[model samples]
Target: MNSIQMDSDPIAVLMQEHHRAAKQLSLLEQAVISINVDGFTRHAFECIAEAIRFFEGEFRQHDKKEEQFLFPLLEKHQPGITREYRNEHRELWSAFNHLLSCVNDVEDGRLRGSSRQELVETATRIVHLLRAHIANENTILFVKAKKLFSTEEYKEFRDNVASVTA
Candidate 1:
């Protein structure tokens, strides 16, 4: 079973999501590296496709949970604390869109030869951006949330996240 499913604590569950994101990003990294070395193999294509699916679905949901539930509460506790994180979310979404377009171009046979670099660059951007964002959330935002949130607030967050993720 996934740690996200096992953990009742909302912060812990979010951390689990971060772990999953890290794994996916690692796959993307490996795929790009393989493309660079061996050219576009089926394995690389499958990895990139899997990454696209993940970012389109679970990644968006995770961000939505933070934006909707977590951010508001954090902002209430400390005004403007979440501003940078919100901005990063916007940036990540933009990169995700770019990556999607690049992947689509490859899938549709729109780009050849150059598609490798395009895919590598775009995936690198998203992977780096998201990894930094997750690091900040795990190290800073989530730490503050744990310290500042009341038990009731924590419960509400857990319940809200569970409802959405379920």
Candidate 2:
């Protein structure tokens, strides 16, 4: 679902990936909450693992495209705003690493009640942060990029995205 078709606009493709990431994060948040209420089970671990894998694979690629192509283009026009968004990306990455660590611990049979609680808390934070991040990028970043880039620049950016993502 994260795979974008060749004909689609690159910005639209990134937005679609964001939506998919949000859905996966919501699933992770719910799974963690369920584990907190009902205690950790194999199913919960599987869900968490799957979410982590999705992030590590597709989501990471999406992040790279933004960082490598989109952000730099935006930064040329809006350095302050781009810097703020890049900081947010760093924070999001830290949160993701925390969630990945928690999942690894669970897989290793270290699912204490406190650990489950931590997982739920971490996942909730990630879900909220990412939702906000996506909204900001969609509304502000992408909109500005669309308006600011010349036709040739936008085409080059889109082609770079396609090359990396393909």
Candidate 3:
């Protein structure tokens, strides 16, 4: 492969997704903070909705790519190192769902008292968890994959990632 192709391989694609997700998480955090303070202005609502949509769609697809295309090879090479990341994916999903629920409650005008608190807390949890999770994968898992995979293996990885559905 040429240098440009090498730079834009599967791992690089995943890293780009990570960067996008981190921005969405930041938007989510700011939206939640705005709602907590100002009771959901139009910009805050839009930001929250946009972030939720990204997570429900692209973020889920990103996770599927890792789980299906990347994790198996890592598991084959290192045995059990992928397990913690798998579990974290599940935890992140749970927290995201909780945040979604909280948003729904707010939309329904049910975000009073404890529900407001729950929304803030859930948003905080998902933001922190996802940020840390992304950082870990970038620094550790993807770095390992880059070092371990041969050129042929990377091509197969890229092909599989392209062919697989979320």
Best prediction by TM-score:
1
lDDT per residue for candidate 3 within 1-166, as digits (tens), equals: 2233653478878888999999998998998889788976889878989999999999899999999989998887789989999999999999889888888888888867788778778888989998999999999999898877767777888888777532
For model 3 the TM-score comes to 0.90
lDDT of 2 at 33: 78
Error of 2 at 75 (Å): 1.2
Question: How high is the CA lDDT of each candidate model?
Answer: 0.87, 0.84, 0.85
Per-residue alpha-carbon lDDT of candidate 2 for residues 1-166, written as tens digits (9 for 90 to 100): 1233347588988999998998898788778777878887777777888788898999989999999998888878767768878898899899999988887787788867688778888888888998999999999889898888777768878899999878
Candidate topping lDDT: 1
Clashes of each: 0, 0, 0
lDDT of 1 by residue, 101-152 (tens): 8888877889877777887998998889889999999999999998888777
| Cα misplacement distance, residue 117 of candidate 3 (Å) | 1.1
The positional error of residue 112 in candidate 1, measured at the CA in angstroms, is 5.9
| lDDT of residue 155 for candidate 1 | 75
Error of 1 at 72 (Å): 0.3
